[model samples]
Target: MKDNASLLRRKDAATPRGVGVMAPFFVSRAENAELWDVEGRRFIDFAGGIAVLNTGHRHPKVVAAVKAQLDAFTHSAYQVVPYEGYVALAERLNRLTPGAFPKKTTFFSTGAEAIENAVKIARAATGRSGVIAFSGAFHGRTMMGMALTGKVVPYKTGFGPFPPEVYHVPFPTALHGVSVEDTLKALQLLFKADIEPKRVAAILIEPVQGEGGFYVAPPELMRALRRLCDEHGILLIADEIQTGFARTGKWFAMDHHEVAPDLMTTAKSLAGGFPLSAVTGRAEVMDAPAPGGLGGTYAGNPMSIAAAHAVLDVIEEEGLVQRANQLGERMRGRLEALKTRVPQMAEVRGLGAMLAVEFCAPGGHTPDPDFTRAVQARALERGLMLLTCGVYANVLRFLFPLTIPEPVFAEGLSLLESALTG
Candidate 1:
């Protein structure tokens, strides 16, 4: 078997530098919340494959579902032959997602596709082209996704001139001094100075900014956006790509809000580890797209659809939504108690298991990405895998599996404490 070093050298030689890898080691195999490297060393997974493993790796239900799907047929492009699993999954999402009106859903192969399609549907439905997004929001890597994404260093560095007519406003962050009123004011200014409200097709937002940092969108901000959308005939799109499934202690983050979105994008943990994304929205809006206007060749692959069905079964049967709250409460309690000793731990925020701790310089608000990196390094040294996010790269977000075992979860937290205070 090739060791990690040898495989890494091969990888570097074969793959482009743009595809970043976090861990030094390469995995040989993974189970629920744990993995062994090519060198046969074990590590506890807290990153959850960047929030793609809410039900954990190789979950029996998901695995079995995929196996069964394999024994059946693999693909005859969804748009070609079509499949019942795709329609069934769509039906489930339509019923599960927060909305009372008649809804329709379309599947895609990735979150970026879902986002791009959502924008297309909105434009077709509203007969408008301008769209609005927020700062610190991460949509995806495609042209439109990159256009809508707020951060620029890595995602949008050399990738312009991107799709035009995409506008951005500051998202509210109380810790960073940007308020809800400030964001609303920026939107108003954008409509006045940039694009008028009548030309805007949609206002896209992440209920909780994902790659930007795990800053939960304030309820006030959500309500205000809904009102603005309603007044202007703009469709409100909630990008629940990272915060979907049971990560936020809710089926969807929008479930926590009083108002519902006109359309929603979901991916990441939607099909356990499989590559599947979906755009679910109002039936009328979805129908705006002419026949054959949407869908991809691999959009709603049978294997991924089956896995998604099993994932839903696991979440319901295992009670992962409530489990998320339980895990988040315990993790928050631990971080809150450790704050006294770890002065650099500036803020502990997130909803349910979708939590993050932002680090800052001692006794000050300046971001300390160095300290954040140090904590992550120490955690990895102790076999606990972690991931960092935020525009400043100063926040450590936790995406642990909701199905993690008690003993393993406790051990991971213990290792995390040592990493923070050590």
Candidate 2:
């Protein structure tokens, strides 16, 4: 087996510097909430593949489902030959996602594709071209996705000349100075100066900002958006890519709010590590994009479709939604206790198991990305893997699998305590 040092040399030589890697070692094997490096070092997986393994790595049911699909045949191209798994999954999502109105669901290969197509559908349905996104929101990396994303560095640095009529307003967060009224004022200003409300197609937002920070959207803000959309005939598109599938203690984070979005984009943990995303919405809006306007060569592969079905089954059978709530309370309590000792810890926020801790300079709210890096490094040395995010890069987000064993979870928390204190 190749040692991590030797593999690093090869990786640096063969890959571009733009593709950043967090861990120094390469993975050889992984199970639920754990991984083994090529050199035989074991790690407690807290990253969860960036919120793509909420069901955990290689879940036996998911693996068995994929194996069964492989035995049957892999790809038939749902649009070409079509398969039952694809249709069945769509039916399930339509029934599962928020909104009691008649809904329709379509599959895609990635979150960006789903977001892009949702925009197309919204534009087609409303006969408008403008879209409104929020500050510190992460949609995706594709052209349209980046256009919708609120971050500047790394993501939108040199990718200028993005799609026009995409505007951004502040999202309410106490960590930042932005408030719900401020958010509304910005939107009103956009309508008065940049784009007219009538020309707006959709207003997209994450129920919980992912890469920006694990900031949950206030219920008041959600209701305001719904009201604005209703008043203007604009569709409210909930980008639940990272917050879906019980990550926020519910199937979809929007479920926490009483308002129902016209469209919802979902991916990441949808297929239990397999690449599959979806756009589920009111039937009329979904049908706006004519047949040929949607679909991809590998949209809804049978293997991924099979895995998704099993993932849904596991979520219900394991009672993961409730598990998420329990895990969130425990983690938040532990982290809150650490804050008494770790002066740099600014805030602990999120819903359910989707939580994050932000760091700042001691006795001040100034972001401390350096200290965040130190904490992550210390955690890695102790055999724990953690991920850092937020626009300021001073927040450490937790995305461990809901299925993590009790002892393993406790051990990870102990390691985290050491990381924060040491």
Candidate 3:
């Protein structure tokens, strides 16, 4: 059998350095919330493949659906032949996503593709070129995605000459000392100086910032953006790529707010580990783009569509939405209790199962990325996997599968506490 060390040597030579990997070991197989490396070392998964396995790795239903699809047909180029599963999944999303108005849905291969196409649809519908995003928000890594992303270091560093007509404003975060009023004022100034509201095609935001540190977008901010979009004829786009599929205790993060977005990008856990994404929007807005203008060769792969259908079925039948809330509350309580012992724990915040804990210098507000890295390292040493986020790399976010067994979840949490306290 090929050992992990040998595989690592091979990987170093075969893969480019641009694709950064977290875990040192090579995954041999995974199931639900656990995985085994090439050496057969078992570890509890807390990252959930960066929020791509909300239903867990190789969910039985998802696997069964894909296997069934494989027997029928595999790739027919959705744009050419098209299939019923694609349309069925789209129909499910239209009804499932938040919004009382008539909606339409289209598929894509990745979250970034959904964002790019949403931009096109918004521009076509509004006849505008300007798009407004917020700081500490993560859209994707594509050219247009990079332009809209708020972070600069890794995502936007070497990749320059990004798409133009994209502007950014501060996102409200009490920990960062930015307030809603401050964000609103910055938008006004942006309109007065950089781009007018009339020229804006859309204002894109993550209902819960993913790569930007899992900060939940304030409800007041959502309400203000809705009003501003209404006054300016700009479409509101919600990037729910990482927060979709009951991860945030809801089907979509936007569902937690009273107002609904004009267009929403959903992926990651949407297809239960399958490479599938979608953009759902108001019917008229979605119809703006000419039929031939949208879609890709593998936009809605039959296998992915079939898996998505099973994913939706599992979510409904198993009540993962409610499970998320239950798990989040339990985890939050444990973390809160531990905060008394660990002075570096700055904050514990998130909605439902989509929670994160920020670390800071002892008794100080300064971020402590060193300590965060230490905790992650310690967890990995003890057979647990964790992921870090935040602009400062000082936040540890939890993305455990909602369907994790109680005994396994408890074991993972115990390991996590030891790592944090040690």
Candidate 4:
């Protein structure tokens, strides 16, 4: 096999530059919280495949379920020949997600598809077309998803002619100078300026903005948005694609708030490491779309569905929700201690294990992307992987698996501290 550099050269020659890559090495194998590169170099995995491996890679239960399903069949195409696993997984999600009222769920192949379908369901249910998203929000990479996303740099740069009737308002963040009241007022102004309240079908938000930095939505802000959606008859869609499935110390991030969304879109970690996404919502709203209008050819592949069921089981059996909280507390404590030594460490924030540390210039609020890059590069050189996010790319977010062994987690932290202090 070629070395890391040679393989990277081959990758650059074959893959498009638009698909950004954070690491130069190619992974050969991964377990729990560690990965080995093609060249046999070992590293601690802090990125967790961008938060898609909350249960870790190739978990025993998840792999066993996939193997069992593969023996039976691979692609029956749920839409063509409906499968029981698909319905069962949907039922589990309906019961687990943050709502008590009757709900229904439908699966998709990606997060972007689930977002599109949720929007369609909301529009059909309310007979409206407009959608209200927030600044710094990230929905997905698809046309409609990009339309709803707030950032404009990489995701929306040449992607003009996005779907219409989509508008963005400020997402409240203390670091960004936006307040909850300011955002709510902006929503009202958007109704008066761009689209009417009644014409808006839904307001989509990430309970915790994922790529925009791990900014947790204020409880008051969630309550206000719920109220606004109720008054305007607009559906509330929680884009929990990043914060779902025990990443935030709960089954769903919305559980952190007392409010409930009418519709929710989830993916990423839904099927452990498999490609599966789901849109779960109120039964009546979900049924708004005609039966045939929804669903895809590979909507809920049996393997992915089986994997999801096992992933849920693993989460429960391993007490991952509680484990996430414990891991988050330990990491946050370490970051906080490092903050005392590194003045550039502007903030350490997130819910449960879904945490991040932001960097800024000393004695100023300016985002220090350069410093963030240095930390990431240093950590990688020390055999630890890290991911940088935020609009300015100055925040280093941590998504290590909850199943990571204590010694491995401690070693990653020590490497992180060295990177930060060195």
**Which is the leading candidate under lDDT?**
1
**Candidate 3 residue lDDT tens string, 1-422:** 97988888899999998899998899999999999998999999999999999999999999999999999999999878988999889899999999999999999999999999999999999999999999988888999999999999789999999999999999988987899999999999999999989999999999988989888899999999999999999999999999999998888889899999999999999999999999999999999998799999899989999999999999999999999999999999999999889999999999999999999998878999999999999999999999999988999999999889999999999999999999
Q: Indicate the residue-level lDDT of 282 in model 2.
A: 100
TM-score, every prediction: 0.99, 0.99, 0.99, 0.99
lDDT of 2 by residue, 1-422 (tens): 58999999999999998788999999999999999999999999999999999999999999999999999999988788998889999999999999989999999999999999999999999999999998888888888989999988778888888988899999888876778899999999999999999999999999999999898999999999999999989999999999999999998899999999999999999999999999999999999988789999999989999999999999999999999999999999999998889999999999999999999998888999999999999999999999999898999999999999999999999999999999
Which residue pairs in model 3 clash with each other? none
What does the lDDT read for residue 160 in candidate 2?
A: 85
Q: Which stretch of 10 consecutive residues in model 3 shows the poorest summed lDDT?
A: 1-10
Query: Global lDDT for candidate 2?
Result: 0.94
The sequence of per-residue lDDT tens digits that candidate 1 reaches over residues 1-422 is 77988998999999999998899899999999999998899999999999999999999999999999999999999878988999999999999999999999999999999999999999999999999999998999999999999999789999899999999999898888999999999999998899999999999999999999899999999999999999999999999999999899999999999999999999999999999999999999999999999988899999999999999999999999999999999999999999999999999999999999999998989999999999999999999999999999999999999999999999999999999998
Clash number for each model = 0, 1, 0, 0
Every candidate's lDDT: 0.96, 0.94, 0.94, 0.93
> What is the alpha-carbon lDDT for the whole of candidate 4?
0.93
Each prediction's RMSD to truth: 0.7, 0.7, 0.7, 0.8
Candidate 4 positional error at 280, Å = 0.3
Over 4 Å off, model 1: none
Local error of candidate 1 at residue 153 (angstroms): 1.8
Model 3 CA deviation exceeding 4 Å by range? none
